[model samples]
Target: MKKIVIVLVLIGLSVISAISLLKTGEVRPTRVSELKSQFLEKATARVDHSKFPILQIKAASPRDLTAACLSCHNKTAQEVMQSNHWNWERPEYIAGRGIVYLGKKNVLNNFCIGVDGNEGTCARCHIGFGMRSARTFSYTDSTNIDCLVCHDNTETYAKAPEKGGAPEPVLDLNYIAGRVGSPKRSNCGVCHFYGGGGNNVKHGDLEEALFEPTRDIDIHMAVDGVNLSCIDCHTTERHVISGKMYSLSSMNRNRSHCESCHGEAPHADNILNKHMLKVACQTCHIPIYAKAHATKTHWDWSTAGRLRDGKPYEINDADGNHIYLSTKGSFQWGKNLKPDYIWFNGTAGHYLLGDVIADTSRPILLNTLNGSYHDPDAKIVPVKTHNARQPYDPAHRMLIKAKLYAEEKGQGALWVDFDWHKAAEKGMQALGLPFSGEIAFIRTQMHWRINHMVSGKDQAVACTECHTRADGRLANLTDFYLPGRDRNLLVETAGISLLWISLAGVLLHGSIRIAASRRNSKRG
Candidate 1:
């Protein structure tokens, strides 16, 4: 009876130990479950914007809706007015140029030249109202703010390009006002995706397709994936959005990088994690850009004004891309394009207005990525190289802003008359600058940093792509020496010669040792 009791006690202890071990080893929830829980927590905490009194009434204009919004959120207008989106200007210090004000308002681009004389059309992208012209526009007016542009969740709010930043009259302001909430991908895509007057023209990475992306399109923004919105990464504070483009920014502005969400070390491999020091996350993640549509890679304004049968004509390439448009110019479109690699530390050297040109013969670099292999903060980043041949003043040595559109008939617009001289003269007059009267086309290049269109891990660039070839993605990069791809003939010859000599010495020594051993054995 004592042995039986002892055995039973031992078994009971074993059972208790096993149960404790099992409890300790059991995984409560997986990563998927944790993500689901987090999503549920957020879903339960959502607020209904319809309950607000300001959004209850019907409004005529976007400004009126904004006035209603300001009644409650009075500081919101002041916060937005201070943002780059409203001001269209940001002060920054350049390398050669000292502290200067730069933005779309001042910076000259190949597309639409500059916003100096075209504020009305360009103001469609602006966050303000009644920006018909630079002279008449008031930046201090808080009532000019458009709150529905970023906050509307109804998806019905839209600003007409020709309406001087006003919302369409047909839209139900009350319905849209009631549905105002967090900004969606579609909200941001309205202007950004259609920049340069068309879809996928300005920023190659951003497109309308991102509104409802699939897992294969973009892993982060995909509906089937994390389904992250633009605001998730572009975390805004005081109505100022983060992530300024290098071309637009001069100073080292605050930006939301991959490290903001993904830690410094996100890879499983230590080797790959170490690579993050010199390799940008987008360099490998976005293997190709313009996945959804073919983006314009080249534009030649010199080729414009070509007419067939006294009417403007257009030519299409083999891939059905617009090669020539009578109104704009010849274009080169590309899809699934490999990015041009560059060393970047977030700083960009922009060609500000009145800046001296380095080379007049070759394509002038509008903006160049600022970094080197020696820079510890620099990394190899991918960029979209947009080439263009646009109008420039030969005498003033500055890019010319041609007046392309006008509300009236005799406004000296280039599209109206097909005369470059008149358009240049009118544009310069509007800007209050003297025209040299000498019009010439010069090749120019702009490097657009690629940051979106993230692919799956399996679609990343292979190791051999850059390691084995001289003309690889990193071919232009000469900051560091690659082993297999870059080799010195003298060093290779010396290494080969030393290897041969060492092999010969070893063979002779082994042969002599073998013969001596056989001789010793025979003597024994």
Candidate 2:
């Protein structure tokens, strides 16, 4: 009886420990308040320039970042040491701090399945050679995001730095004027823009041409007079892994931070407004059309049903992971049927026409199904759903398939389906420049402008009134627009036609004059 009681107690203790560990998993215990409080305590301490020379970074190598700065600056080093920035270009996860949060299971690290042949996405952000270097005959340690990599004013900073001498750090009043605080773009931009051999280069362009002193326009690092620095937004906080100025941490991780600036949300979502609350504010209230503004994690699988091959496509748990479709079936795609979908139905998964796929490569296709159908609102849906299962469609079957493969299989191919930049490129192909995805940008802003003028006559012109989703996200447009109201889609049609006609008239006049001159010459 005594032995049985002891065994039961041990079993209970084991279960409790396991449960506690599972809950905590990868969530580090360092609270936002704690990080903030510690930053404040250290930020108060003045930098003793005499002890830590400003010129010390001039000779430092990329690998000498921690050693050069951390030795003298313990608190600041500790603060930055735990940051994703510090661990940016390195392949190994820094212990105690600076861990990458790529789901509980890091698919980037090959689902943490031991870094051997492929060092995962470590080199993309790390300072060493990742897989390519590892495979080479002359391989060393992974490249670290060293301080000198960006700050050293010796080696030329090129897109590709094949020539290995350190580039010169071009200092202007904007960067070295001490006008801006620490952690501004000038500092962060150095590593963020150029570090890890330019891995995290997204959203904004950082090319030298974009920032030529002569040019009046530069979108990414643009200022009215001078360039911006890293410290401008980074402020004093460290361990900053979150995206943009709107991140919870950027607003100081406090609810008051949001309310104080914006006041109460004009369209605050609550339990009463279930649909509105579920959707993020950015979906509707986007201020700008910045490409890298925000990203949706889950793919829009609402159109997954359209991928059906007409046959009874069986859902297989072949790998014990659920992915609605698999390639191990008899009726393999591309091998036999030449799908009619336009954009994403090709053999290589590229936008090409008439390519034959004689083998199975379980490519994902998008819904290229096109036909004007009335939505739930009884309004005509303007969206072009080109059936990917068909051929020559603009829908992305390969991308969807890639995303699914990543989800089901612990690892996947090195290619990602669609980034916003890639999406912009696609939009550019469809709609010419100066109008590439910029239409979506303009349309989004137009909605906001209309919403802001809600009190006035524009209240009736809100997006929900005319262009609404099937869901209750949109208000009924019937009362607002009087039965059939779609005047906006044809808004610029007349103006465009008039512009083309005017150009043609001018060309005709020129042609007549040239023809008459030729006839007169023959007569003379």
**Which one wins on TM-score?**
1
Candidate 2, 1-524: lDDT as tens digits: 99999999999999999998997686653333343344334232254332445323453443343354445544654545445444322222222323323211111110111112222433333333222322331222223323333332322332112212122234221122112223433334444444112221121223222222221222213443223233322334454433321100111121111112223343322431342322222223322221221111111222232334543243523332222332211111111111111111001111111222232244322112111112221212111111122111122211111111121223332122222333334422322222122211100000000000001112212354324434332232232332233345465688788899999998999899899999999998
Candidate 1 Cα RMSD (Å): 7.5
lDDT of 1 by residue, 32-116 (tens): 4554455433332176767887788777667888899899888887899888888888888888877888888888877767887
Evaluate residue 388 in candidate 1 and report its C-alpha lDDT on the 0 to 100 scale: 94
CA lDDT for candidate 2: 0.28
What's the distance in Å from true for residue 232, model 1?
0.4
